[model samples]
Each structure stands twice: as C-alpha cells, then as structure tokens.
Target chain A: MTTSIRLPKELKVRVSEAAGHAGISSHHFILQAIEEKTLKEELNTNFYEEAEKRYTQIIETGECVSWEEMRCYLESLQSVPNPIKPIARKLEFNVKN
Target chain B: MTTSIRLPKELKVRVSEAAGHAGISSHHFILQAIEEKTLKEELNTNFYEEAEKRYTQIIETGECVSWEEMRCYLESLQSVPNPIKPIARKLEFNVKN
Candidate 1:
C-alpha cells in the first residue's frame, strides 16, 4: 500500500539522510519506523486491557492483595543469596486522592 | 499535569461504561490505558530503530548474510529433535522492488 505523507522540508531532509546512512530507501525506512511504532502501541493497549480486566475481577470478587505483600512474595521467590533481589523498586498505589 | 481531551459523546459513553465495569473512575482508566499505549509504542520504536541500525550496518559493511542462514542458526540453538523447531517462517528480503 502506498500513502502520501507531508512533512516539513527539514524533517524530510533528515529522514532522507538517515535512510541513506542506513543503506535503505527513504520509503522503507519510514514504513519500518511506522510499523514498529504501531505494533508497540497495539501490544501495549492489549496488555493494559488484559491487566485491567484481571484487576477488575480481583477487586469485585474481594480477592485483591496489597502491592507490598505482592512484592514481598515475589522477592521471596528469588534466590536468597542474590543481593540484587531487592533492587530499587517503584510502587504504584491505587489509592484515590 | 492535566490536559483536557475532547471526545465524541458516544466514545465518552463507551469509556464510562468500560470504567464502571472495571470498577475504576473513567479518569483513572483512561490514564492507565494511555500510559500502557505510550509505553508500548516507545519500546517498539526503540526496538525497531535498533534492528534497523544493525541491518544498515550489515548492509554498508558488506557483511550481509541470508535470512535462511540466520534462521537455521537459531533453530540449531533450540533443543532439537523437537518438531516445533522448524515451524512456519516468514522471510524478509532486503531487495527493493
């Protein structure tokens, strides 16, 4: 499929240069970039939807577990001798402000 | 930071319904979904760029190898005698049309 995309002359120049550096045609480079981006977005959307569905099931059924407990359990599953087991962690809280 | 997003009434209704089913506020649900999509897109873009860069390097350095050879190498690495090793394969040719 062929499509027309309008871009600023500078941006077009940059893309052409990059495509040349990559030893590929400008069209192929753009197509590949777009394909990568679209695929990523789609995968992420599906993952989030699945996660939300599971979370909803747990919440409505009163089967929810605290993030702290979940983290501790995961940590315990790792080798005890590994010091890297308890690395920097960022926790997400579901509490409403 | 918060930004207002305009959506059609029907789309809004769908989002609201989904939020209610997920047992979360529409705002939170939308935020989570957007986050998931953005993350996925970013990761995919990076992956594709890296692959393209490597491919370009191979092309420019005259170190190109057939996709068949690479697939065979990967298949050999798998625990063989397993029929699953040689599953359906899609070959990508760099030849320009």
Candidate 2:
C-alpha cells in the first residue's frame, strides 16, 4: 500500500544517511527504524507500568527493604564471632519466608 | 556507618546463593547488589518522568505519528518516478522544521 507523509527535512537526511551506512535504500532504512522505534516504545510502556505497580505495592505494604539496610545486615553477619551458625540460621530463616 | 535490619529469610538465602555464584563473600555481594539496585531505581524514576513529559507533549500537540503511516510513507518514496529530488526536498524541509 502507498501513502503520503510530510516529514520535517532533517529527519529525511538522517534516514538517508542511515540508509547509506546500512547499504540499503532510504525507504527500507526508514521503515526499519520506525518498526524498531515503535517496538521499543511499546516495550518501555509495559515496563514502566509494571514498575509503577510494583512501586505502589511496596509503598502500600511497607515491606520493601532499603538497599542500605539489606547491605548493613549482610555486613554484620560477617563480623559475628560465630559467623557460621548465624549465617546458617539466617539462611534457614530465609528459606522459611 | 552501621545499622540493624530485619529481612525475611528467603531473600537472605537468595543473596547468599548469588554471592556464591559470583565467587564473592555474601557480605560483598549483598552490598554490591544493593548499590546497583538503588542506582537502577533512581535512574528508572528519572526516565519515567521524562518519558511521561514527552508523551504528554505528543498528546497535547497531536504531533505523534504512527509507525504504520511512517512505514507506508517510506515505501511510497521508493516507487516515486523522481525519488532523489523529492527525498532531498523533504530532507531540506525536515531541516527547516
């Protein structure tokens, strides 16, 4: 199918240059770029939505642990005099949760 | 410099496993992952805000072009009797915009 489009000039030059670099006609290059750009936008939209949902859940539940806290907790586990027992206990606790 | 935290058990095990897989002490692995996750979340928040602004602009201006339309337009350029001149003219037009 054929259609008319009115693109600003700079974009056309870019498409032409991209086509030259890729060893394809400008038409093919433009189509490919449009396809790739559209797919990326769609994927990003989904990712953002999912992340937003997870963020809201974290906020509501107050169950999300900060990275700093998690890090510090891990650090203390190492400094304990009987590190093996505590580490093992923590691992067992983690498995239960 | 130091703080106490209470994490559920499953996460602790996963961190330990990850640390083992990476050939690092669990303490170091947890610290690195925490740092990486924090940075990623911060970056993603900024990206989402920027993308939302751009999406709103496109909606407000009605200037967002569909991929299908763009693809078809590129295809038409190929079948044009005088393709080069039109492509050049369009590119110049784009530059002006």
- For TM-score, the strongest prediction is 1
**Residue A6, model 1: Cα distance from true site in angstroms:** 34
lDDT of 1 at A72: 82
Query: Evaluated against the true chain A, what TM-score does chain A of model 1 have?
Result: 0.63
C-alpha lDDT of residue B41 in model 1: 48
Output the number of the lDDT-best candidate. 1
Q: For every model in order, what is the iRMS?
A: 12.4, 23.6
- Which stretches of candidate 1 lie above 4 Å from their native place? A1-97, B80-97
TM-scores for every predicted model: 0.37, 0.31
Candidate 2 recovers a fraction of native contacts equal to 0.00
In model 2, pairs of residues that clash are A8-B94, A9-B91, A9-B93, A9-B94, A9-B95, A10-B94, A10-B95, A93-B9, A94-B9, A94-B10
- Compute the lDDT of residue B40 as modeled in candidate 2: 51
Residue pairs in clash, model 1:
none
DockQ of 2: 0.01
For residues A4-70, what per-residue lDDT tens digits would candidate 2 score against the true structure? 2344465456445545655777555444443343345446666887999978876676556555556
- RMSD values, in order shown: 18.7, 24.4
Q: Please give the RMSD of candidate 1 to the true structure.
A: 18.7
